[model samples]
Target: MPSLPKPRLRRPARGRGSAVAHAPEPETPNVEVVEHDGLRWVNIVQPRQVDRAWLEEHFAFHPLDYEDVFSRNQRPKVDEYEDYLFVVLHFPAFDKQVGRLNAAEVDVFVGPDFVITLPNQPIQPLEYLFTQAQQRDDVRASLFGKGAGYLLYKIVDDCVDASFPMLRKIGNKLERLEEDIFEGRSGEIVRDLSNAKQEIINFRKIVRPQRSALADLERTKRYIPDDLDIYFDDINDASERIWDMLENFKEVVEGLESTNESVLSHQLNDVLRVLTAFSAVMLPLTFVASIFGMNVHVPGQDSITAFWIVIAFMVGLLGGMFYLFRRRGWL
Candidate 1:
């Protein structure tokens, strides 16, 4: 088979300092679709490079949207331009072996006749959509013509669905960590909990803003078809649920940290108590030895029998101190 063409790199139309300009170095794949047969069936593949000038000549995408396409680390949001809808969505993937979350950035431009998607990395949702578009005859039939809105809705919906598995994995990991914390596995468990909490926080940061953006999209009266409003509402609901899940997870993590600290503090107090008891028992014994070791002629130092008497006296004195401390509940 012939090799596919290399993807083009396209610079934003605006200057480098522009708020929505594309990154100078393109690290994501650009996917574009051409509608045909009153159905929209477009092959989804990552272009090796994107040519902004070429896109300008061929597609009528707004300059700002194009800049968004090339921009690195664009915040999740929705911007409706005069002729197109621009949106950024986040899809998170958890790598079990690595114990981390990988968040992919997907940027989209929906025009009257075409749809363009740019991703910071290859994401599973787009791959699944592309594969289904090719292999499923029903999908192929509806995707091109009357079902463009439906197709867009399905893509966003699928992305939201994909997040659930990652969330569940995180939830499970947290549960295990909670068990470990309770079981007295302090050191490693605490570190892992910290890392997991950070990942969840970062994920929430990406998700919450997107939730607000979706809410705004739902409220606006615009070119979006009436039938598609429900789909957007579904997306809004899913985003809200994810937000809530993250918040709950954060609270659980905080509780785990606090519990871990309390356990550690208790252990430290136990150790200190043992040390203090030992020191108390030895204090009188040290005093007895110091008096006998005096260089001047002392009452107990003159005879051989005096050493035995001193040893007996030291033992009795240590015994008395132990009894007193025990009576005071200090031992």
Candidate 2:
């Protein structure tokens, strides 16, 4: 087997008198090279804004790629430059107390010799990958140098895979809510379900564009090497799966919402029915009492037994009305 050539170590640029003159503006950290298993990787962490002069002096990244690093809140997508490929992806994290998905953006630059990752917000998956890379030399080599393209694959794959745990947590919550809805305690459950739906909707908003972006990348032949195409396919497939899960979750939530509304409506109808029945039974009694209380002379008002007669008639009327209502199932 042929031996891999040793990777050249490039020192950071310094000013005259070797007094490490920090660039007036912060420079994106230079790539850190790690080698193992005959592969080399140059990992670039969060990239900061670089002046044109600094870019010219320090590295050979395309000006447009540098422009993308400074671009604010870019949608997930891919761009092919003459010398490298640019990709943007979002990863999901949980806001535990709020119970929502917080997506973080990661912009990547992959070239023949280097891989640069820029994250606008805290992304858990990439941090996990970095930790793993630190622990495993072989994994570090596979990510850093065997192919810069492979590093892009690892980062994206890890991001996509991290979504599963979040999705599972949402699924379990949905299940618990489903039980609550069935148990006739849907007020709190419905509200929580609504929050979950919103989170899923937000997640879909973030992931759907990435799906199209990955699909676009898959079709392009300019930037992705033929051998690396499979990795992009994996990313696309993962995007599709995430989208499908979100869609299913949306449908479930809509169904649960409908069910919650139905239950509330039914309970309200029952209350209204009971009130109507009570009013029906009381109507005749009220009419009889009103007639007896009037000052005008009436046959019932003339006799001492009239009061007893009215009372007996009222009782009989109320009983009959109740019986009729029960027979008709209106009560």
TM-score for each candidate, following the candidate numbering: 0.80, 0.83
Q: What is the Å distance of residue 10 in model 1 from its true position?
A: 23
lDDT of 2 by residue, 1-331 (tens): 1222344567787667876755565444444445544444444455554433443454567776667667776787888777767787767766677767766777776666656566765577787787778788776766765466666678778888888888888888788878898898966676787787898888887787778777877776653568888888987887888889989998988898899888888989999999988988888889989988888888967677988888888989988998999999998
Give me the displacement of residue 207 in model 2, in angstroms: 1.1
| Clashes (candidate 1) | 18
lDDT of 1 at 304: 79
Task: Flag clash pairs in model 2.
Answer: 40-144, 40-145, 41-144, 41-145
Report the C-alpha displacement of residue 91, candidate 2, in angstroms: 2.4
What shift in Å separates residue 255 of candidate 1 from its native position after superposition? 1.3
Instruction: After superposing candidate 2 on the true structure, give the runs of residues whose Cα lies further than 4 Å from its correct spot.
Output: 1-47, 50-57, 95-99, 220-224
Looking at model 2, residue 233 earns an lDDT score of 91
Tell how far residue 294 is off in model 2, in angstroms. Answer: 0.8
